[model samples]
Target chain A: MTLLVTVFAAIICTILWYKRKNDEMRLGTLCFLFWGASLMWLGDAIFEYAELHEEFFTPAPADMLNDLYLGLSVVALAMILWLIILLIKDPKGAVRRALQKK
Target chain B: MACFLVGAAEAIVVTVASKAIKASESKKELAVRSKGGEKAVDALREKQGIPWSRKLMWLAYLLWGGAFLLAYEHVWHGEVVPWFPFLTAMNDPGDTAEMLHEMSTVGVTMAVIVTVVWALLCVAADLILKRRANSPLENA
Candidate 1:
């Protein structure tokens, strides 16, 4: 479930990044982040599949909720990190000037 | 919170480790090249900063993605509400297939919402950056 979520996010991000390749919003970074996540999830799915075999596909409801929470949390964490990076880069020095004023 | 904590911890560890490795590599470059001087050091740093660090991006990706997947097995048996007041087809998870299909509907809706929000954020950030660049203060 988490793998599916990340893959979906990655595919969307990749398409967005490709279309806005020349933009200063640094879509490339976003693409890299999502794709990296997708790959990581892929690895996890493989290991789980190996361990649980057929049982992996039909997860219990409780299991699904946990996966859903995990998926949401991961997406949130990525957004947080990216926001921090954007602030640091402050491509326009907005943060820098704000700090200087302080 | 457990999922978030693990993800945050991994991000911090990966970033610090990458920075340490980069710092060490800088020193190694200085040792290997006797006459490259300050120019060489600057070049190395530039290379590191050009378009941002792949290590940093990958760290976020792996930690975020990996942590979530790891948490799934640990929490999969948890209960979830499966109800759609308007769409009867989307309600009542009688079995795994029906449940997953319902979940997929929710996932698609959430993903679409997230993507739209992210794009808007990028646009706002770009506008802020451009505004600063064109400011009278900057021109002065």
Candidate 2:
């Protein structure tokens, strides 16, 4: 479940990065982060599959719900981190401009 | 249970290697500057592709971030403990075997995937840089 969430994020970020005229947002970094996470979850999935064999596909309802929440939390955390980096880099100088305006 | 450790370990090694590479690069830049001043250093940079150290740094950052988050998740699930052995899986011999198996399989694959992706990104970046350098507009 976590893998699925991160995989989506990675794909979306990759597209954004590819389409960007300039790297103001540093979407490339975001893509790397998501892809790395997706890979990590993929590894976990593989291990789980090995352990459960046929049962791996049939996760319990409560387990699925918990995984969904965990996955969302991971995604949210990644976004927060990326936001912090973006602010620090200030590639577009938006934050700087706003601060100066203030 | 301790699968994230593999990525963290690789990240540590990569960070050290990146620092070493950066130091070597600085030395080379200094040598160039001594021979031909600042212009020479700029020329050297122009001739060189993006530093491998920077690429490694990217990998290191990715690994570290992923590992940290995964570690947090493990801790949330109580798979990891603050006590002596640290990992709950270590309590039982069978669980320890399973944990080791997960580490070897999942942990290894995670690291490998990140490395492969980083390598591909590096290749793509090099190609793009090469094209930009060759472009007439860029030269102008």
Residue range B1-140, candidate 2, lDDT tens digits: 88899999999999999999999999999999999999999988888889878999989878987887798679879999889798999999999999998788788988988788888989999999999999999999
What DockQ was computed for model 2?
Answer: 0.47
Q: Is the docking of candidate 1 incorrect, acceptable, medium or high quality?
A: incorrect
Could you estimate the TM-score for every candidate? 0.45, 0.81
**Which candidate wins on TM-score?**
2
Instruction: List DockQ, one per candidate, in order.
Output: 0.10, 0.47
Residue B104 C-alpha lDDT in model 2: 89
Interface RMSD of each: 9.9, 1.6
Per-residue lDDT of model 1, residues B1-140, tens digit only: 12223344655776687677767775666774666877876766655442223444455544544444444433433332234332233344565465455335433333333334444545665576667768999889
